[model samples]
Target: MRSLFFFAPLLRPHVKRFALALLLALVTLVAGTALLGVSGWFLTATALAGAVSFNLFAPSATVRGLSFIRILARYFEKLVGHNATLKLLSTIRQWLFGALFPRLPLPDRSLRHGDLVSRLTADVDALDEIVLLAIGPLIAALVLGGAMTAILFALLPEAGWIYLSSLLAAAIALPALLIGVTRGTGAALVEAAASLRAHVLDAIAGQDDIVLFGRKDHTAIRFAEAGETLSRLRRRQAFATSLAAAAVTALTGLAFLATLYFGLSAFQAGTLSGPILAGLVFGVMGSFEATNAIIRSVGKLGEASASAERLHAIATLPSAIREPLRPVALPEGTGIAFEGVSFAYPDGETVLDGIDLTIAPGEHIAIGGPSGAGKSTLLALLLRLRDPQHGRIAIAGADIRDVGLADLHARVALLSQDSPVFFDTVRNNLSLARPEATDAELFAALKTARLDDTIRALPRGLDTVIGETGTTLSTGQLRRLCLARTLLAPAAIVALDEPTAGLDRETELAFLNDLPQALANRTVILVTHAALPPELALRTLTLAHGKLEATV
Candidate 1:
């Protein structure tokens, strides 16, 4: 319901355009109905005269002119409608991205890659059809229906009553059944399709890993299930939509039969002129034809509702992290303090509890712990990736939560366990850390990571495409590259996660030894399993469960 309300404002800017287009549609509807009535009258009049209708050429020419005007108005309506849809889609997507995402804190990737893309494209497209095609036409149909009833009544009151009754029945009943079923099916179909997209994309993206792990068959089975689910939903929706259309078509036929039978009776009684009877039947039926458009318009709303729900689901998450409205500044040289901080991931046992620690400015703090001992969690708190449920963390004299994330993030740079890489040139990958960095500054950091020589040997050198996730580079090399990028930034605090976790003795030592020089005056927090360089850290601590224990 919020989603529907949110979208209402999107139409305001383009209201004028929609208004003009609707006017054009009304003009076209009137002209088309007039043509149908006039054509029928011409035949009936000829029959009555027992000769060519008086002034046949003049009537034909006038009818032709009206039709030509109607054709142009129809074209104009279509043109404006398309433009309005595109504009509405752009505006709505902008809202979904800008207003929604910040409130949703997805610490981990929840949506599948392709499904995420589909949300931006296919989902929006579905809603676009509903907003432009469905909403606009429904309004036009109601207006046209009233006008058509008036025209029919003016010619033949009984016939007008019959046509209006049939039209109302078809218009209400068909959509109530079709779109009623459509609302549930559209959401289910969209969910199944999104699941399918996400599943297939994950399969493809993780194909190598799956094959390596020998889980290909299991993955394949899940993927097939996803495909089948989507297909079944779509098939069910199609069947229901068709059934409603058939009902509408059947009613339409009954209305036409009634008009024919009654017209013959009225003519025989000499209560109705043949020409007037013809005009009433044609004009009334012509207006009722828009019932088809009404059903189509109404059907799409169901799909749009489903799409809106999906978007709202992601948008209205219980955000784990919140930014300050007015932020305080971090102190110079980054003294870090964690004051009895406690936290746990949502729906999980406590990951960190009663954690208290402090690191003076320019100090190298090496944290060591067994796997799942909350060493990483402590680092997370410092970076404010995960906020504390209890206590406070501070940068010098100010609480970390008091500072806005944008400012806080700029002060501290963290290199996590996963050294993620993009499918891009090496230069741009490094630039992700600092987009405005100079080539010389980038090269200097690469040199410190011992990657400068390796990059120089590449075919494209610094500009070489690394493929997605830097497939061209080995794992250790990717880590070094990421480290280099993070090192390039002039953050007040630099935190490295298991910097030497997978590297060999030689490379690991080289990196560890150079890290201090690379960081210079910045406070360093290193999360490692092994002993850190004694010269770098003045004090060492171990994390067991969630407590921080100091050791000599």
Candidate 2:
């Protein structure tokens, strides 16, 4: 229940619409039971009246009015209820995305992409059941059931007691039974469903490797096994729901029979009219329609709870870097200095130790070393993706931690080896860097990266759709496009991590020759293992054994 309250803030904005929806649902349920009870009484009363000068006008008019009310109220009720639910879902999804976006370079790679996809899509989708299936129906049942009890009590006290007790028992006991019997099954189904999605997505994403390695049969068998497991879990949940439905139906019959027995006694004692007795009995029977919702919803309570817990866990994960409570303004210059900066990973491996370095404004420097020499780690620290454990990094005199992340990012742009290109049009992908950039600016950046001609030769030029992760483009083209994206950013600092990683020597040197022109006044931090081309005259530094030293 505490987990469910996490959405309280999100629901506040739409409280009015949500309340109206619930009220409509209550009115619809009341109209349904009232229509049933009144029809029973009208039918019985008319027969009695016919035996002694029947007055059909009043009963006929009342019945017709109720029938129209029932039809119209039910129609509007469904419309409003569904609209509120959809709006709530939209709010929840937006909130979930906002919570997860800042934690981008997730600390753990083992938390597979497929699993996150499951949480973002399927798990978030399950939250709708909380409002629509559980809370809404439960409230309507209570309100309508109470009104029915009051009407029955006025007609016959004994009949009212029987109806109220039976309805309450079915509402309470049946749901309790459903939760007890199906909680584990609900949790199991959710787990199996998520795992199955992960395996299927992983399999599809790696289909090429599986086929090339002749492990297609092995992959197929694993996929089938996962499908079978999910199928079995779903079947268990279905069976439990069916069982609860059957139990609720039986309880409905028992409540009706008990009401009739007491109602007949009242008729014999001359305390209740025949029509009134019949009306009370039918009202008792029809009220269980609300209880049916409670029954099915309880069966899935465990699933909703599990989903809520998962969302809460993700929303509360510790950020790899912390922001300041009172952020100071960014300083005038973009020149960066790392003072006594040291960082160690969770596994106790020190990636950067006692590092002190400074790059002046508009200076171009290349950092070269073998793998695991902390070149990339330095770039990460400079970008503030991860904060140093022991020291402060300042930009132009103020600590980077004192500066707002957005302001810092606006001043520094990174172009890395594994930079992502989305499955979108070339213009849309490039626009991600600067959404308000003009066409001329975009083309200029592309030309500086030497990718303009490649895009121009394409059938749609900037509007062409690149496949997922730029699969349609060659490795060199993808890297160049990423560099172009970096160039589009209006930043004073550009950090390139192996920018020419996959290009041939000739192409790498050509791009190197163009770098100075593209980044004329920006402070540049180039991290690469390759030797710098002498023509570029870049200051060279080599990081070895956790210390920085100048190279030839």
Candidate 2 per-residue lDDT, tens place, 16-114, comes to 877777777677777788778887888888787774686777777877887787788778867876787788889888988888778766676567888
Q: Kindly report which residue stretches of model 2 are placed more than 4 angstroms away from their true locations once superposed.
A: 44-67, 107-110, 208-229, 268-273, 326-329, 338-341, 353-357, 368-373, 390-392, 422-428, 451-478, 500-510, 529-536, 540-552
TM-score of each: 0.81, 0.86
lDDT of each: 0.78, 0.83
Each candidate: RMSD:
4.4, 3.6
In candidate 2 the C-alpha lDDT for residue 372 amounts to 94
Off by over 4 Å in 1: 20-35, 38-78, 107-123, 201-221, 265-280, 324-327, 368-371, 417-490, 498-514, 528-544, 547-552
Candidate 1 per-residue C-alpha lDDT over 325-371 given as tens digits, one digit per residue, 9 for 90 to 100: 77777666589888889988766779788888888889887888899
